[model samples]
Target chain A: MTTPTQQRLSLIDVVNRCDSFPYPSDPRLERLSFLTFIVDEIPCGRIHSSVVPHIVAFNQQDRPVFHITETTISFMPWLADYDSRSDAIAQMLNIWRKAPKSFPSLSGWRDELYGVYTLNTSPLTTKGGAALAIERSACGIFGVHAYGVHMNGYVRTGPRPHEVKMWVARRSATKPTYPGMLDNMVAGGMGFGHSPGYTVLKESMEEATIPIEIARNAVPVGTISYTKLSKDETDSQPETQIVYDLELPADFTPTPCDSEVENFRLWSMDQVLDSIRSGEFKPNCACVCLHFMIRHAVLTPENEPDYLEIAQRLNRRLEFPGCKKWPTFKEEQ
Target chain B: MTTPTQQRLSLIDVVNRCDSFPYPSDPRLERLSFLTFIVDEIPCGRIHSSVVPHIVAFNQQDRPVFHITETTISFMPWLADYDSRSDAIAQMLNIWRKAPKSFPSLSGWRDELYGVYTLNTSPLTTKGGAALAIERSACGIFGVHAYGVHMNGYVRTGPRPHEVKMWVARRSATKPTYPGMLDNMVAGGMGFGHSPGYTVLKESMEEATIPIEIARNAVPVGTISYTKLSKDETDSQPETQIVYDLELPADFTPTPCDSEVENFRLWSMDQVLDSIRSGEFKPNCACVCLHFMIRHAVLTPENEPDYLEIAQRLNRRLEFPGCKKWPTFKEEQ
Candidate 1:
């Protein structure tokens, strides 16, 4: 058995030696870095708490060919908060080496870059006896997002120059949890035992009042990451977000169901942009959705003639103020 | 514990008392019949077994509500075979019930006419203990003949007026199990353990070369029934089917992934209708799809100018050699 310090060094060395990290400019290569983070920096303890991590290789056609390695790590924050970074790194390496036992001959790993962060410390268990603590550790999440590029539909005159409609949902004032806040059309924490897609689909029905068929119609855009906030940072909880973008008809109406949402409205893009600029859309929920729109070019400068850069700037300036800061490391190009 | 005979008697008593049995002629009462079958007949087996049953109730908005009753009965050929009639009725109920689990709760079950039928089963079990089974039992069988449809943007012309594009999939010749048979775009055994939608989705992806998104758009039109063919019917397999009405772009192209399809061609509606009329389409895969299309108006008289009566005759004609006999019962509506 290797000491924790030795394990950490071995993992760091293996990661540095492996040519898996992609060049920063190449978006595809970034997956390797993310995979490394999942397999190296994040404690195996955290992963095992939620799901078993498996390295699956897909053919050029995107058909899963085989698994190169598989392992279940626990989501134990204590493992992540070891006194030395080397200790944490070593634990991760030990877990990686053991991963092959579950999935023998896996070709490579796929990275799901975004996940939900929740403070609920639940012990997650699988049928196969793999178990992990979910609340304090990083877990890979999956989900579907209904997404489409919103081109300028016929515009109606409004106070703002561009009358593009933005979908906004009001968090249910009557909800036993998270009452009286503005939120995305649909958002929720991915639970330990559910697929991200299944989780999001469930959330959309529960929160946004979107029909399941309609929700399923939402295309799966790529993923996004939100750093988890720490308890001391703010009253707001720590959570990483996996965001999916969906497009609705400009005239689409949402009827809130359950206690997740109280109401919904179609706001003009300019109004939303102005709200962001004025610090009115202060919640991270709004920021996440807004970021998705920007990343996907759902709302671009050209399309939103009255769109102000200040809104974008404000969104960028907002940080997960409650999240704990990790040691900063430079990535090689 | 009740003996199998006693259990059957109890089930029969339950079915007789429930409003679903003996098939209601009034369309409004038909919906009750569908729900009654689920509540009374479906056994309490897992959803993915060879002989599972289900019931689904829909509100005014067509959102489904599910109820999985726990009951299991032995297959008794000696005791009049209830599988045939019960099969279609049960399947329609399951689809009805399962559909809404995906959406929000709408209205409560009220009086409204709804269609019902049985379909082939698809079953699956994840590495997790979660198991899903869509049984091809008596409840899962049904038929429909839709008319007036176009495929790949091409209108039918020539001797046979309606241009019909039927989806035909050849069972994998290399597959050790169920090899080289004609099948629906989606068809599988009961123990395969996958959802009906998932099974069909896989079928469409594998056999039709349709993208997952596009394949999901295919809508369920209705269902059909076929009597068990032999004394060993419980052991002997009867072909199962679920009908869908899909209207594809006229220019749609299908890229066959494997040799499952020996060759495919677009037949003019007249030819397809002629084939059905002449009994040339046969009882294999092509006929099943054609049967569904004709019942749903995808192969309508107006669309396929030549086969106007084909669908009508199919529903009423019991003499068609390929058509399975409708199950018989002492009580009739």
Candidate 2:
């Protein structure tokens, strides 16, 4: 008689893996003084953090970028006299580009945009001053929150939906961040111009070679948020990641179409669990996978003792400015 | 061409409907003293509150149920010497039954049991001393959090997968709580001695006449939790609802096997939204429907502005004894 060895992971181990999400300790985010950047007496962004000193120094030569008093910084409304208000911003950004030491980027351009809001409730109030590039917002250059979309792609197998096979992506070794680490099959930033739905569809096709029809059917599950105070306490990185789930047919496979992803492979739940335990998957992507597992009955409440805690902790409260003026492509389309 | 009067809700209005979850306001919960109910030095339940005066006043003739002090109240551990805890609890309940005013139930029985726990690691600690009835716990008589199962039963329809039909139930007029309000097709308190899986199966059969085989397939989705402080500020109703989802065959219909439900109906998403906007469904049940809508992709982030907030708020943080040793029927089986 053969004695069977226990192969199933204990629920606590799975919950622990989900709980082990890593946060980057960027010292720049800490101890920032709040300086509201106002446009025509309305709030546009939090412009003057401790980084304000650096911004002030960077603006020494170019067209007096800001008129800063002790507590507040206001864009010179005369900027409207310029050809484009974005040009005024571009001039400042271009100055920083020359030094490149202050603002670091492998690719100089972050084509994606984000909304900057004001107290005045109308587009006439913006005066061409309501947009920021994708990457700079994470540094909280102007103290604004950023948004994105992440997806958990999976295939079902075994008899009677008994097993989950996750499609995992290995980040390209040459990628700027978390290179060679594991990731979800598709993930992308939700920039100013695109809706969460449009962004997901676009990213799916570009990153995973997933067709538009399949991507359009992706489910909007929920969100995960975090407010990371940079290691120096000068910037606040407040981000909200809207999560999605795309269930692929058993025969479906994901292939990387871009340099961002090195390749894609399907792994059984146990193997995924092993990799997570070994600290392999990108922290946030691991959380997305865990959230999917909890919802799909893969981790039953009975098996997981911390079930309630895990569910509540997955989507933490984000400290982003309340998103009233944010526009999306989904609604516009 | 006739101008079509707008009949459908905008995505934001639907999202706001999900956001309007209300919590009961009670002054007592705001200032309750913490009295740890310890078992072998591991804190188990918060045994006593300002409500203890009321419990003491109600149990005047009982076998002195508690050992109360200025800061704490404890059960007589010697009660464990008795073979059947149900009998001892039954005797106290019988005394309350005679008064009826203090312990009121239309059926005079909750018929629900919740696990009582001690921290020796595993089910062996449950020797019948580890369970309490639902009503008593609600009164803070035992200081334990009650658990239940709530489900969303949906039927898919329409071309392009654009439509979803939900199976909703109307609460019976004579039901003691939230009478005539709408509810999920399947819901039942996870009374003592049953696992989450077992209870879902049992409740599905009794509540919706869902066949056992189909009920067995009800997926363990996630959980929702809230603490309701009573109107008079005397009692705290802390509950952890383990939510489930069972996709019914499009042809299958639920019939009321018990009078707890007046009837079941398959309503399109629009009708459900209207009823929810009018505050017709029990608050938790309405949120569950939104959770289902989100997971099914009926409510997308593009359409709902508060998409992130709604998803995070669905599983509110619960204030129960952290569930480390709670035993469920599934674990036992």
Candidate 3:
């Protein structure tokens, strides 16, 4: 009897015996990071979860410096102008904290938001005053997005901070593709030459039954930039991804019209982080989103008053001239 | 964002909730093991390659014991009797050594052989007795097979076992199923109450360019039995499977008439196994058949020549009333 190794050899030699001709002018492929959220049970207690931002800043020796604070990691890209760097970072945080009002809103101050952010890195240079070079040559803007929904705080009886009931629509078990999987509330590609906001809005309306106006209000949070790798040798260009954060009510409900979403549910901050750690969440993008929330302390179980105090402290920490401490947790209010 | 635990809970709760009302059984609701070959490359020196079998013994303990070996496996029910076990095992080894006088030959002999052997385990008892319980139960049988002409031994310039000239019929990638898949020989299970030999023969003729007489002489090599699990209260009854082994001439040539097989090539054994490992050879019955092959070393390279020898020795060892090394491979081999 032929062994598995033998069988595999036969198939491989037969299938790949012929020399493969290279195709010129093919678009370079890239690898990009996607974020998603995984909410566990409804918030019921003071949940403690560790946060790890995807971004890493390397020192002279290419070593990472760990920083923990009350909210948000301190790994923002450095700008040539110190003031501009601080301003840009503040703007990004503001977008994350308060849902941008410029975008449309769900009925009665309820809304879902999705956004994309893009950034590029400059090559290391000996000259100190060199102009900041866009990393576009090596990395191209590919996609960015963020989406959120609002719900009444009554979904769970515990302390509520404007509950944002969010659930990933389970992919249909019979779906022609990605069957029996998890899907995000809103999904879109940046380089597709389509508007991420518009795409997410359409996706929200079609998938989660969120009203069109509510999806439109999704504000641009901060832009997240990352590089991607390519699987094909012919395509080695790096792809960049931009991300935006949005806010929603706690009591909001989603009515799925598409069969892709078998069902949905709500989760507490602890449950969400636990699910992420356990690898139970679907649609990996959801896990990224949840990670962001944890790192920012945006989904803690604290009541509104406590949450406000925590948020205030976080804001103060970010105001530090050279805040090395990545946000760890807000002092108990 | 909802967590995975929340999603799992919701799914479980929904299923439980629906269970309150008696539900009708779906015809497709059956325990199915999908098997396929993954061709991989390994260093074997002058030996070229060897076949290893992986077995999934269903309902053995509770989940199933996946046993791997370097011996041929079979599942023909006719060989269930202890007396037939010896001849059956010998016949299987013979098929591997000497290809039967059939067109489309046993190009996929390893897969078929392994499949049959795997099916045999379902009827094995804890005491290692033949558990032919499946004979009294209703069962469905189906198989998807393919002949990889490029995988034939003629392609290799090593010690030429036989001078066989053959071509493969290419399958259409546009076809609804098994698109672009190579096929020269294929056959599968006979539904309950049907003649296994007749069913396989019909399939051979239909899918492979083999003569009926040669197919008939393919011979029954061994029997694989499965034992049902009593722990699964959800599944009221247990199930079993049995498979047969056959061989064809090394020099056999085939002319595929089935549109499913579009093109053909003559490949060495190395190529064939490689294709299976690499997933280039996609057979319709891959799931179950592969499962069976893995369980039973129908055509394992290590035991190809000595399967009969080993089986005979095992029988001899069993005959010894007070054998100390009963279950050990060292004593048996």
Task: Please write out the lDDT profile of model 1 over residues A1-333, one tens digit for every residue.
Answer: 223443232211211221122222335532221211122222221122122233221112233321223433222333332122234333343355456644221212322112222222232411111122222112222111111111111123342212346576666667653477555677665433344456566777776667777666443322222222222211112233434545566555777777666777676665554544443332454445454444323443223321222121211111111111111212111
Per prediction, the TM-score for chain B is 0.39, 0.75, 0.33
Ranking by TM-score: 2, 1, 3
Find the 10 residues in a row with the least total lDDT in model 2 chain A. A20-29
The true-structure Cα RMSD of candidate 2 reads 7.1
Question: How close is every model to the real structure, measured as TM-score?
Answer: 0.27, 0.74, 0.22
* Interface RMSD, candidates in the order listed: 30.0, 3.9, 34.2
> What value does the lDDT take at residue A232 in candidate 1?
26
Provide fnat values for all models in the order shown.
Answer: 0.00, 0.56, 0.00
Give the runs in model 1 whose Cα sits over 4 Å from its true position: A1-131, A135-164, A174-178, A231-240, A295-333, B1-333
DockQ of 3: 0.01
- Name model 3 segments beyond 4 Å from true: A1-165, A174-178, A223-251, A282-287, A295-333, B1-333
Q: Can you give the lDDT of residue B93 in candidate 3? A: 39
DockQ of each: 0.01, 0.34, 0.01
Q: B84-134 in candidate 3: lDDT tens per residue?
A: 443433343344435333211233232231111111223332122221212
Question: Between 1 and 2, whose DockQ is larger?
Answer: 2
Over B1-333, each residue of candidate 2 has an lDDT whose tens digit, in order, gives 112453444433543343332332324334655565544344445644654665576446546665566666555565442234445556655555665565444134654455654434333434433533334333345556666788888776864333778899999999878899999988987666566778788888888888887787678777766554444433444566788877678888888887899999999887887777666787667777777777777666666656666776666544444444344555556
Model 2 TM-score, all chains together: 0.74
On residues B228-251, what C-alpha lDDT tens digit does candidate 1 reach at each position?
A: 222212121122233444445557
